[model samples]
Target chain A: MTENEINHIFQTWLKQHKALLFKIVRSYAFNEEDRDDLFQEIAIQVWRSVTSFKQQSAVTTWLYRVALNTAIKWTTKERKHQDRHESIDVSQHIIESHQPPDDRLAWLYEEIAQLNEVDRSLTLLLLDGFSYKEMSKILGISESNVGVKINRIKKHLTTKSEKS
Target chain B: MEFKEMKKIWDTQNDEALYVINEDALHRRIKAKKMGTKRKTSFSEVILIVSNLCAGGVVIISHLLKNSGNVAALSMGAMMMIVGAYILFMRSQRIKRDQQTDVSILGDLENAIENINYRIKLSQSMIWFCLIVIAFTMYTVLNSDKSLLNIILISGFFIIGFFMSRWEHKRFNLGKKKQLLDLKEKLINEFEM
Candidate 1:
């Protein structure tokens, strides 16, 4: 495919699924600047990878694979240098009285922030409505393992939310 | 709340996640990225290049000027410098494992882990190669005449280099293996299969 054709296809994907890309980036990047950096990186990667896209699967799945793969490295590589696997715990985010956002989304983001690096990516996939099979496809795990981890992540989020 | 319910709430999440990016700007950046995607020359690599050029120049000049007993030793120094530059150039062109994004996450994850482990291994080997050469070069350049002191100093440098490489591997590479194993355990334990 020509570069212009690739650009058009990518532009459409971005227009429709930019939020998906954003959530993936936000999961890994600490701040706005980092988010922008990762976003550009993912964009460049997707643009590069688009022509090779066989479209055998959903574009969403392929896009998730690229974005998550990129973000995982971006987040883990720095932590790997420090020999730490646990990602930054954003559980302590307090909503100011005046700027009350959606409590569920805030809690959701906080809990995701607290998860281990692998689980953070997996749970985001789960939340985005990917099935066990699709998660397994994207994550390279078995269907059964996806079910197990999804339950574990859900139970943890629920138990914490209930207690508070 | 259950995940589905939370997901519903997540779907309603204001377009706070949205960031406007222009097509033309993205195209330009992609063009720029594609143009500049060569594996960057590392800081150590720059040092290697500069040292090689300067050292090679000095020794070759000394050999030509016919400094007493410097002829053979400086010629050897010049040759080693050429080899050093070649090593650094090859080091910069080291192959990176391609992340197979279109496959299973388990396979991709394993590939990622293997890539990290292999890169660490490459650096360790490179150090050993560079150490021997650097020691050889220093020995030849400093001592034009064969002497007991020359062998002893070179041996000392080799030993020091060996220990340093081991220490560095323990500090950096081992953690990557542990992280990989941890992920492995997390997967196996989660499924109990």
Candidate 2:
């Protein structure tokens, strides 16, 4: 109820859920520097918005809402100035860094990178074991829509994997 | 493996190995008011709107004082400010619309895809505005001085500018629109709808 209580609670949530920030950021940003920047941006947003949080939704759901909004807004701006990224294959970066050892995870990331911004967010939430109802609440969509979309998305990806 | 299985895998890959989330560092960054990432779109938009307003203010003030009859400057300034305001409004509205989805992934996809369309619209309108400004300015110049050579040269320049804008649309914005469309379709297909 008190401001300090809300602040303390939010800080704890943020600290414990640092990985939430990372998962959301990686879906939006292209490189290490961009990821760091997005993470900072999301953190600032959380800091500002957490006090106003009504506690109507789960803290993680609310956090995802804020993070996704920031990422979507940031991506729209970045898209205008970024060079043709396809021109530069990511294999070089893959070589240059400690890579994702799991090929399935790696493939998942690649597929996610190709997705539209919102789909990417939904997929991230889905992969994090969010229920359809929870995703619906955060995304402002219906439960059945989430279920149908998730089913379709899974079928789509699996079909792609099979064809390849 | 199933997608659920993949998610299970994703949940397991913790960030402890590399860059840990430094709460102290985040607090410092938040306190410093450096919330933005490296890109400066908001900053630049503010700069753009301010500059346009100043330019418009100067032109309108000068015209009122009758320093010169260059009404083109007033129109250009006014038009640019309108465009800037429209862009700023759209962006703010998108950000402020609360949640795009809470019940469905389809809602999220639709909102996201719609945002891309909005962007394409922004770029298209900007191009048209520039062309209209150029056309109006040239007409004003022609009306002020009616000479054959001037007409010929001005028409030539206008034609060149017209073509140049078309080229720009093809070279830049059209390609972007196509990409967005493809992505939208991909999302649609992802849901098998």
Which number leads on DockQ? 1
TM-score of 2: 0.49
Per-candidate iRMS values, in order, are 10.8, 10.3
Cα DockQ of the candidate 1 complex: 0.19
Q: lDDT per prediction?
A: 0.64, 0.63
Give the residue spans of candidate 1 off by over 4 A. A1-12, A29-34, A37-41, A44-48, A77-100, A158-164, B1-3, B13-19, B22-46, B64-144, B158-193
Clashes of 2: 14
The structural similarity of chain B in model 2 to the true chain B, as TM-score, is 0.48
| Model 1 quality (TM-score) | 0.60
Give per-model CA RMSD. Answer: 9.3, 11.4
lDDT of 1 by residue, B1-193 (tens): 6657888877774363334554443334333332232222244456556766677787777767775666555655676577567756665454343422323322233334344444565557657666656665666646656577876787777678777867766776676566556555755564564
Candidate No. with top TM-score: 1
